[model samples]
Target chain A: MKPSEYDFVAARRRLEAKEKSAGEKLTSLEDAAARVTNGDVVAVGGILFSRTPMALVHAILRERRTGLTLVRNLMCQEGEFMMAVGAVERVVTAWFGIGLPWGVSKIMREHVEGGKVVYEEWSHLALGLRFRAAAMGVPFLPALTMLGSDLVAIGPMKTVIDPYTGTTLAAIPALYPDVAILHVHRADRFGNCQIDGYPHMDADIARAASTVLVTAEALIPDEEVRRHPDRTVIPGFLVDAVVPAPWGAFPHECYGLYEADFEHFDEYAAAIDARGTAGVTEFLDRHVYGPASWLESLELWGAERLARQARRAHELVPATDIMGGLSTPPKPPALGAPRQSRGAPRPPDAFTGYA
Target chain B: MTTIASPTEWLAVVASRQLRDHTTVFAGVGVPLLAAALAQATHAPNLTIVVEGGIVGPRIKPGRLPISTNEMRTAYRATMLTGITDTFLLAQRGALDVGFIGGAQIDPYGNVNTTVIGDYARPKVRLPGTGGANDIASLCRQVIIVTAHERRRFVPRVAFVTSPGWLDGAGGRERAGLRFGGVSGVVTTLGVFGFDPTTRRMRVDALHPGVTMDDVRANTGFEVLSADGIDTTAPPAADELELLRALDPERRFLG
Candidate 1:
């Protein structure tokens, strides 16, 4: 379908219809997942391996939601698992891979190849801009990306001669998801969300979606949230429900909370390698379905293992003591300082010699 | 003195030499990050490393390199932490000097394909489609592709153009309405490649030490051209190897 055919007006109406109440918005994971019905355009917040809404995704899977269109900047284990279990019929994403040592996701590849799923590819910037357009209530935004790439031919983006510059620009349509599930560091009972470290694309995703469901690591008091108004990425008015799921983005790292469970990824990779779709089913049975709740799922991995990951997270980003403010301002080497002077003599002309 | 550098170490070292000091580089994950880290640790101390995950000017920690760009490790000592939209907007406004990325397939025209191995619809191998690659390639001042050189990878024509190089030929980018940025070179395991000034076809500009013309010809699917008096890529120096090894002590990326 052409991007022009998208129901922008209906999307706007849906957003307008949502209650803007400032009352307690806290809810259960299953209840929050229930906000997402079948065939909904669901946008998941966070980038690959970080801050992904895995708890909500698990909840959605257990709810047996199907025919959903999954959206994200980068597709990781959550998207792969969703596709593996037939929860997703389509995926609109920039990239889909396990990344690094794991490489591409075999399940995603098989699904796409077998014609069981439709994958709509877009450049990362374009996807982000699309969400931004939706958040801003604009129909489309012009961009310089995907001008000469095959994505131009395949994706929804179309080029138009710029009226001002006489240059061609790819017109990216505004993407309004039916529901956006986000994982945040903290959120108030009233649903004001704050994210530590990098806010991948959650802020825009929250605003762009008609219904926003947030799975936060902790539910802080409204007074605490008010103290750091500058850190609130998702305002309460935009949020419909908030599920306080600790270690919500487990197996995937949440900045300042814990490191990614590489051992679990290794186990997952091995499982998929050993048995394809059946392996994914077995994983879900053992981790997702077998356990009644997200917290119960966490118990599968012993406390020592979870603690080690949290310790590693602290080590990686020493300034995790947010309430106390930055303990030590990062001191990077002086720009252009000759740090290598003590080692090897600088090559005469490393840049120009090759050409 | 001979430094027994692994293939990836050699690629990282050669790729690092491509960057100038104090330039803002949009670095992709894996080897690109390793090379950028090495560059910052060595010659380009002032180099600003931008990850698509919105991390800018991060002092990449040794041995704890982020497997994914958005991981907390990538944000350690980062000069700026912005959203993905704002970060890519920086590139769109021509703030980035270099874009360092890797791909599964590259054509003679330097066009890269990380999307699919066979057909787009029903593919033999479906890759992790273009993330920020096409954006970086389209907006950055220049792009450098770092990938393993092999016959299957160096295709006569990419099945799908996830990132545009010089599309078709000489004025291809211009004809296609791309006003800024084009591939400058491709740093590979076997050699360093450059594009022809007029034709824009891939050419062997510098062969890495111990790699032969026959190796280039045999591995590349397209007709490989050679630059006049093509210089041999300098071997990884002792200090460069030390820095690269230090960054990847686990050999997670260096291998």
Candidate 2:
């Protein structure tokens, strides 16, 4: 039931109070890494390349933690974020999508191929599985999908028989992560976070975790929260801690804050198409690996670097305006190669109509 | 002989091989598209791939095609342009042989749910809208489900009904007199499973190569039976991969 008499003004004040309080601690993301221990199950929220909380993950890597398992719906670009920093021992996910600058690095792929880390693959639905189990207050759910399909064996699955029917069924256990991290657009005191844009599986991850860490673009007033309650994806009851982090979804799109590095993504996809993972590795090291600061990622691809990368990668670069002053590198030929003037006289036989 | 391969590759190979020669197979987005394209190239050269938007065997671009309508790019040469309803009608009239789909939840009885992740009234999560999955799953001669393996999706009960597989449970389907052959098999990123003949309940019929029984059980949501000496599913050959690529230039609708 909708609350009667919305008090947006009071909600706004409450949010401000929460943000001011969190600002006092100002703990470096690196310090937060200490909370994750070896062999702990972790779930990081976000989808494709949108709203992913890389800032928190970056802090974990800075601490160089290891022997921890990551469970989630999507974990790709930051895979190297786990591998390079030695913060992860194994990864359980539905699929891995890595691009050039922030995607799966060469080292991570090699690790997956070399068995340095266990690659426990699953379908995108698995993310929903965890959340559904959490919401249902059940241990696990049964299913009949992907049974005869390749996911069983190719995924290296083991089979068991249902005692009830004596018929065999594939049993995939429900995932329960000890920690879940998410990045959102706004949050109020008490941890009710709102996502202004496409929210992939962020809410689901938040529900499945014992502790939820949130990084928001801003801390709105409690009154504003009441005014726009529909925007809140996670209720205050589910969140543990909230930090206001700008550009939190760095190298990825954050609804109102920063646009996705599409030019970089194109470059990364080309790298995967051309040199495979090695190219992807070199690209990540230059942009996502070194500093935990988001500014550093932008700096790594400063104007000149982005142009050069785009040229070599043969991609259509984004309009400079969309870049929001990353220090534009000398502009290269505009992407789609500016169309020739329509009024120009056609060259002698240039347009011979095909027979 | 060929044996089980990667989940994605296995799906491409098996689905392609199963489609008859020159048959027009109507596939939903994702694995079904991969299966149809691979089959067209390797097994059924004359097969016509009809995307929801009417593109027929048009070259598929890369990345995920979130909706069935995205196949329009490949439907360039399609014999017909149709909407979701039109496509389902084709399946109902016996104009299509195979239908590939994905689901959010499935029960032992073969019932499928792509709507909500939890129980009917209250749900933990609500997914994208269901298009023609119900009609295709219920009307098609053979329906192939392609999704990843998990306990949540392979649950014993679905919170909602987006598509009917076995209706209630064992014999629930026959009792309801549900028309159309039910789900033929499930191809996951892990292994392949089929329904038991007697119980009409889903079961593990084979495993992909290098995968073990324990591995399958570890990820599956429900208890499953194994064949006396479960055989290994065949892997895709180089030619099959090339064909798959040809049909899907951008690698759209795949893992």
DockQ list for all candidates: 0.68, 0.05
Let me know the TM-score candidate 2 reaches against the reference structure: 0.48
lDDT of each: 0.84, 0.56
Q: Second chain only: TM-score per model?
A: 0.96, 0.84
> Mind giving the per-residue lDDT tens digits that candidate 1 earns over A1-355?
3353246787778777768988889899999998899998899998888988999999999999999999988989888788878999999989987776886888998899999999899999999988998888888898888898999877667888999989988888889888999998778889999888888899988988999999876666677677779988888989999987777888898886678988888888898999988888899999899998887887787666776776677676653343224111111111111122122333332211111
lDDT of 2 by residue, A1-355 (tens): 0111012333234333443232222244545556666766777876545567877776666556678787655455666557645567777654454421243345545566555666554444433444545534444444433343223334544455667976544444444466777887667656777764235566756755666688765555566677767767788876767765555665565542344555666777677667765665566566556644655554555544443433321222122311121112211122212121233322322111111
Cα TM-score per model? 0.93, 0.48
Tell how far residue B119 is off in model 1, in angstroms. 2.7
Winning candidate number (DockQ) = 1
**Predicted structure with the largest TM-score when compared to the true one:** 1
lDDT at position A308, candidate 1: 73
Candidate 1 residue spans exceeding 4 A from truth = A1-6, A323-355
